[model samples]
Target: MIAETRIALKNAGKYKPEDISTYIDLGGYKNAEKALKSKPEDIINWIDEAKLRGRGGAGFSTGQKKRFTNEAICDKCLQKYVICNADEGEPGTFKDRIIMEMDPHLLIEGMLIAAYAIGATKAYIYIRGEYTQSISKLHIALKQAKEKGFLGKNIFNTGFFLDIEIKLGAGSYLCGEELTLLESLEGKRGYPRIKPPFPAEKGLFGMPTLINNVETFAHIPYIIEHGVEHYRSIGTENTPGTKIFTISGDVKKAGYYETSLGVTLRELIYDLAGGIKQDKKFKAAILGGAAGTFVDHTVLDTPMGYDLLKERGAVLGSGAIMVLADDRSIFEMTYSILDFFKHESCGKCVPCRVGTTQLLLLMNQAKHTKSDRIELLNKLLAEAEYMDQTSLCPLGQSPILPLKSIKQYFESQF
Candidate 1:
């Protein structure tokens, strides 16, 4: 029997989301007090040992990202920044939205700890403009945090000051990308920036910046409260802690469910989510959001871990589990996903700008044309691979995921 873990979602559904007193009653911001007292290096080392990877699809080491900004040699620039990528624009991923709306204080507390760790005086929560409720909740939380001395100058008399503000994004999918988020925050068009200098080195007006998504920031307080061993004991060795999966489509109960990293797909679909909707046979599930790969029932028992999914050419992108019933057509699903990517692609680089459109065209052809469908699919696969290699940001590289999955698992559908 697979069980649900609620470390990140601990306060979710348990209290009045907008009320800071409810959050305080539940021991919120306790970690921030503890984190403020400890040395930043100690906190970084503890996170590194815990192996808490980023929850915003990439699964990169969170501790390493913090260390980079904390250790960045930017003597010339005294200003540093921390950004919470609360865009949550990924198609089937709404976990971040839940965290923001339900447990706003958790996110604020996490950001406070993160800003202190990197000595960042200013922080911004770059949320999507469409998430008006979430924005309102965060605004209330931030104000309450500041009023309680959790934010602002000389917090807790530690002389480590931080100020957090909210920046609304204009609902661009590309803005979910860190560089593009920075660009949008800077009042420029949301364009993916070049990589030789990552956000850690030079970000947010040429100052060292630490940016993580809402879910990633939500995990900081838990790690700070319980030692690394406590977190490691819940999930696999390499991928520790619980993850909030936003389950949708063809499921009896399709919402956010928090579980350990190693939970199998079968358990998620059957025990936790109350089986497929109307007891239909499970066909496939997209492991992550739109940029994630599809998996069949043959791998239902496979453990959901970062390294394990990578071996299968899939990603735990944003922890989105979009299930497909036997009645669903793989071709239609592929077409819709491709269409979204094509529509959302920012026309900055040739690979993403043109490649996504080309992939969408081929998908259209595959869906409508009966003649030479296999040839079109073959060409589509090649185009997706080319885009993966040449694209500027992750948005362009996403085509390869569904394209490869369809070719490998559902080629007969074509």
Candidate 2:
């Protein structure tokens, strides 16, 4: 009987998705108005004090990112940019789309606060193209926001100006990565840029850019509206605030549920999601999305937080919990996941481009060649390890997570 602690999703299912006034009546933009009057440095300090981690998988410090972008040195006249990563490409992860379609204005207000905090007048919502409903709802929400002075010049007469535009992603999973997403935003092929010059220093159009995902941005207003103490009162000491967990697969009531960060997987699966479908025995759960690790029933009561999961060699990536029944085939699921990585590889670097294909081929060979299954599994692990060490981006490095975790928990199947 673990209850949901809804913060970002507070307005969901409670108002008209396309109506701006309803969102306003719910006291949506009041925080943004209050934020506009405050000094940008003070706002950044407030976010720092709140200890809001990025909700879009990375769990980085939101305040640190803003501070970096704000303090970054460029041509004094160069404009900074705020971009929202709404690609939502991770398999079984639909929480961002829900935020966009259900409460688009919340995202807008969050972006507004971010842009103001970082001294940016322009913002973009780079959303997945296939999300037709999300795109349409955001379009209407942007228009409504512009009409209401929530956007554009001199918002709340504070001499601050901000405008947000929507950019459609052409269905590339690689673009969900922040650096790769930046390349796509610039109309280049979706390939990841090298590090050391991270996005905070040199991002979109070679300016200081503040890039945060939809869920991360959506949490800003809440943190601002409720003081840092109130915000910290929820969730764990290190990972404060609620997380939106999207549960799918064999669960009886599979969908998105928002709760505090420390909720156990057992609570999420057996209690909230109604357990495995048809009373079947539980086998394993993919705690994150496709790129996430697989876990057996032993870790069910482990709290779902970034640090807690990381300590167990797992990630709370994308907060996507995909359950599996004992009757399901782990090998088949592993193969399908490998095949997906193979298709999504951008071919930017040799490791991912060839490694993904080789992994898939090796899996196919192992499936048919029963005697060498262990040998092939070893080879797969080695190849994934190589790719993890050498790949240019996360897509190439990600196969190791699922491959290793699956092998660890279900080697007998292979």
- Give the poorly placed runs of model 2, Cα more than 4 Å off: none
lDDT of 2 by residue, 1-414 (tens): 899999989999888879999998899799999999889998899889888899888899999999999999877647899999999989989999999889999999999999999999999999999999999999999999999999999999999999999999998999999999999999998989998698889999888899998998888998888889999999998999999999999999999999999999999998899999999999989977889999888889889889998877788999999899999988888889999999999997999999999999988877776666667778889999999999988899899998788678778765
lDDT of each: 0.89, 0.91
| Candidate 1 weakest lDDT stretch, 10 residues | 365-374
The TM-score values for the models, in the order shown, are 0.98, 0.98
RMSD of each: 1.1, 1.0
**Superposed Cα deviation of residue 3, candidate 2 (Å):** 0.3
**Backbone clash numbers for all candidates listed:** 0, 0
What lDDT, from 0 to 1, does candidate 1 have? 0.89
